[model samples]
Target: MTAVGAAAEIDTYMLAMPSPDSPVVLPQWISRGNTHPNSRYQDPIWSMAPLIDNPGTGLVKLHWKNCPGPLLDQVKLAAWTMINGQLRPTYLQTRGVQARSRSGGTDMLATCHEWMRLARWLHERQITSLAACAETEWRAYANERLSQVSRDTAAIICVRLANLWAFDQLSARPSGIARPPWEAEGVDDFLPAVGTAGGGENATEPLDPRVLGPLLIWAIRFIDDFADDILAAWAERRRMVAVAAAAKAAPAGWAALEEWLLPMARAGHPLPANSGKSEIQVATTYIAALTGSNRGQVSRFVKQYGLAEIAAERPGPCPLRVPVTGRINGEPWREHVDFNEAAELMKHLGTAATIILLYLTGMRPQEVQGLRSGCCPDPAPTADGTDGRRLIHSHHYKNVTDDDGNHISAGEVRQVPWVAITPVVHAIRVLERMVPEGELLLSTAHHEFHSRHGHAGALKKHTLTLRIESFVNWVNREAGVQGLSDQTIPEDPQGAIGLGRFRRSLAWHIARRPGGLIALAIQYGHMRTVLDARTSSSYGARGRGGIHAILDVETALAAADTAARLRDRVAAGENVSGPAARRALTAAAHTPRFEGRIVPRTFARKASTFLARDGIVLYDNPDAFLICAFKHDNALCEPEPGATAPRQYDCRPGCGNTVRTDTHAHQLRERADELDQFAAHAPGPVSKRLHANASRLRETADTHDATAHSAEALT
Candidate 1:
């Protein structure tokens, strides 16, 4: 046979392997023989062919694996080519080479896998080339794929196929080959609906404060009062185990001088045949059953065994406890944690620290997990001489991408102001002590059994997720036992609290709460600024951006709430103060009521557009109403936007933006009464000034009363 014919035959062969001297080399992470057991890529057929790239010529090749005979022949005949002194397929050059060279092997491999699925589908239908495929055929293929997999997976397949067909039209067709029937249509037209190919809305709801608050209090108490004892006990247990092991392997006379220590060898002796087990053995068995560990193992050990004994002998009262009436298999049980169980305790502490950092600082979960031993540094004094709050220096990994859309290994370091709360700071200190310096704070040390990749010292996202759920359950149980049912963390019927929700929750609370709660006020300003800057930059102004998206949603809810309240007052003939208040009331009359907490999408869009006019934002203050026409330069509250939201706490009575509701009128009347009392007892000059202030307050109150009376008469 001729050389060209032989080469053509070799390319068409389904099982033909690449030559040993081929330029392409599979990526380091890709498995060679059968795929690695832990690999996410589980497709046995796809796993056979590794992703191969040649750096020398900037080319990558993906050989089909376990491909049917007809599919292999069609791909070889249709789009295979040699480019840049390397043999590759045209599709690979169009998609795989760029992905491999500029991004990473995973991306390139993913594209290759998609192409393989498309090829297999076409071959199954007995189609030879792209020219035979059309919209109807594409839809049929998509439906078949969807039946076997998820909508997302089917969408991906359709997208990849569409891209390949487009590439075939542009680059693969030879002299006699006809163009594909759908060549004129863009790839998107033949693809699934845009959002159908992605995961559903992420659970971004934050942990309920009722749940978070008690957990934080318990965690702080654990760190400050009990953590050291737990650590020391675990260490002592380790030392005892080491000593016992050494005594077993002693050089003959190691324990000769210590007669008391020698009896420990007999401690493991089985209970006598007719004798009932001791109270300690029964307790050990009960704890084993509760914790789901081994009963024999728990009873045989000494230093780490007899959890009840450890609890009884501990220096202070044990922080962990079971109910006095707790029962296991109808036997009375008391809660006691063994020294060896300190590992699980430490895990809980780690989770607490993670929660404190994530929730308090409004840091992303990734940012909290990325924290190393030295992440939280002592607060430096500000220019005015007061010591500032602590600052957390950690890496922000999300949304960091290189020019080619590849994730940069070490993300940008962001310094966030730590919440001034003592619990938050104490939690950071405790986490630092848990692991050695330079290691991640939320390491996998506590729950090593759950980790599969020997990431015992590196926390995983799923691990944190599970820990948070467990922490909530534990906190709730403890609260119930202590008769603090009100403190129990409320269960979210929607879903468990997730890592991403912390920052968004912070933003939502800051934006929606009336005058903002004090606990939030102390930290919200700095958090909102950082989040707004990050999210606004990442996702443009109009898009539902990250944390900013939550803020926007909350803002809409707040506005709708404000409108509803104003409408209720207007309907009941209550007065509203200021010209803007009147205008807002008029607007509210026409606006529809929000049925639930969630503002409808159409209403939200309209509200956003409406609220944007005149930089208007409503602030629900207790003493006075505020409709901030936020003109930064003209603001009377402050020279510039500062940490505290100006409209909420710094509203100036004389500012053009200030407004008042009936609640404000009540506050004014109370102030007037106090001033009148002071004026009656003061000397002449003081009394005159006090009287003038009192008069003004009364006049404002009367004005509100008269407005309400007029509205009532009109109604």
Candidate 2:
């Protein structure tokens, strides 16, 4: 802890922590290939009953399976917790969750694989720990990767790089700028793209190694996170199914009830990492229900069960069962052995319902998990034109803005009107058929999964990824399909899919498919840019005087068409912009002005940046350029899910809009020549500042036309 003066100290610290004999162990290699404990517990076929429906009666069983930690997983979880001690609650509903606070007697220190990697990064950069910073506190917009987490999560991979470089804890930092330490190449990744025409030195100053330690830990954490993402995805779905089955089950005796509740809730149990407290509570409540008790009387019985040791300390196979009456719509929602394949989905009604809800509403898992029985529309405000359609309202929302663009308080309602999709409808139908009979659309006996970290029905950020992963796996297994890609990115360096992919996929479909939401929503305020027009924004934005609706029907169609083509182009190794070249140019020529100019449209350039921004584009493709490559000379956005290498794209004069000229023309692909004239021909003061930090940029079509073009070349 004393400024990490030597390598031996790290060994000393590890030794001081959990001994090898401890039940909790951090192994030598932190890679995904590392071995973990396989669960030894297996329920008799008869014990395999649903837990939620009969919480008060059925037995509570668990098999503690080996759970691996991913670097990013640790970062996200740790970063949030580190920022304000905000551990989420377990959703037992019978009571709220509270953590024992301490001054400093027991503090935790977590970092990436080695202290040196972190030390180098931290020692070289000047980053103010967002753990204690604020949005308004930023006086200048520096370009360091600045993230403030609500949970104690951090990306150990990127963040750790900064911690080991420099240790200037007390030096003044540039406003808004931040940095991770230099990489193995001995170069910092998050700096202003230098010498580009318009780039600036985004780093305010170099950070001391000690000050940058937090970042190194955060980045490596992400690396580890992605590595373990696949396994975690599988475990998550299994957990959800169990928890859901438990929520509606009948309560059991005190012994069973105590087994269900104590781990995540009562004093002796430490909340399991990754698993939310709410989900656990939901499972326990249902487990108790199966044990033969009701929610009201379950608490005392649980305490007794705790005294008796009925609650298994680990996780594993159990008989997930339900009473005959527990059948959802006269069919077992969890087990339907009597039903044929067609009737089986009647069992997966929950999974399908969840997937549908998430995709349609675009709400994070936390929002859905926090949904309550009464969290419906007021019917007071005249239902907007979108009334009959399924709407998403975030009631009791925290850390998010409402539909009206208002910030919501913790436990406040925030609703988002969702465009219903076929899947969403399917999910609703399933939910209608499987409604718990006693609570909200999504409910639990104690609402444990929903309240994973802290409260009666608490939800956390990871809940989204966890639930989505579960749904996706079920979809893959149940659909009996392979090679199907939704919006998710690939998880394996060689694999091809993930969760965030859904949103992007949705956007891609909407942007590329003429019939998708962004296109259709235009008539109803899902706007797009029209060069020089008063209505230049999309979806909706408040302008100088009026709340202008900038969405359009034609442009939507064009963009959607282009988005679909982009997929083929991506597959064919072409830039996303190349596929939509003429269309983007046309749209660019007609910039619409709502309250102000909509964003500058960089079709090919955007594709390059996006590819670089996300690892979807092959690293070796010379054309791949960070979207901000032109925006900032030095900064490289983090790659998207599924990417492993950190190489640039295949370069071409017209590949994308930006590239790094500092190293070589081929260092990155650029779409510079394709940028709209407004930017390409922008006054020197503007254009100069834009790419100056970058070493150079490709010549625009106009420049080519003026210099070397025949009339045909000009065209």
Residue 440 C-alpha lDDT in model 1 = 73
Q: What's every prediction's RMSD, in angstroms?
A: 10.7, 23.4
| Error of model 2, residue 287, in angstroms | 22
Candidate 1 lDDT by residue in tens digits, 4-106: 4555466542212233232233233233441322212212222212332111111123455645565554443222221101223443455432332122333
| Residue-by-residue lDDT tens digits, candidate 2, 1-715 | 5443343264331122212232221332112432324211121111111111111112222211211222222222222222112111221121222111201101112222323222223334443243222332221221233232211122332333233221112111212223322323233333333322221111111122221222222222222222123223323444544544444434335445556555544656432222233322223333433455454455454455453233335322223221222322244323321211222223233433554454334444445555544333333444564434333344333233334332222334432233343344434433433335434455433224232332222223344345444544554453233232332222333122233333323322222232222222331112112111233221111231111111122123233333333333333443322322333333323333222112222232343234332212221122233211221122143222232212122123433333221222323214443333445777888876555523344433223223331212222
Backbone clashes, each candidate: 1, 260
Task: Identify the leading candidate in terms of lDDT.
Answer: 1
Give, for candidate 2, the lowest lDDT window spanning 10 residues.
98-107
Can you tell me which runs of candidate 1 are displaced by over 4 Å?
1-136, 143-233, 249-337, 409-424, 445-453, 514-521, 525-553, 568-574, 578-580, 586-615, 622-639, 642-715
| Candidate No. with top TM-score | 1
Candidate 1 colliding pairs, count: 1
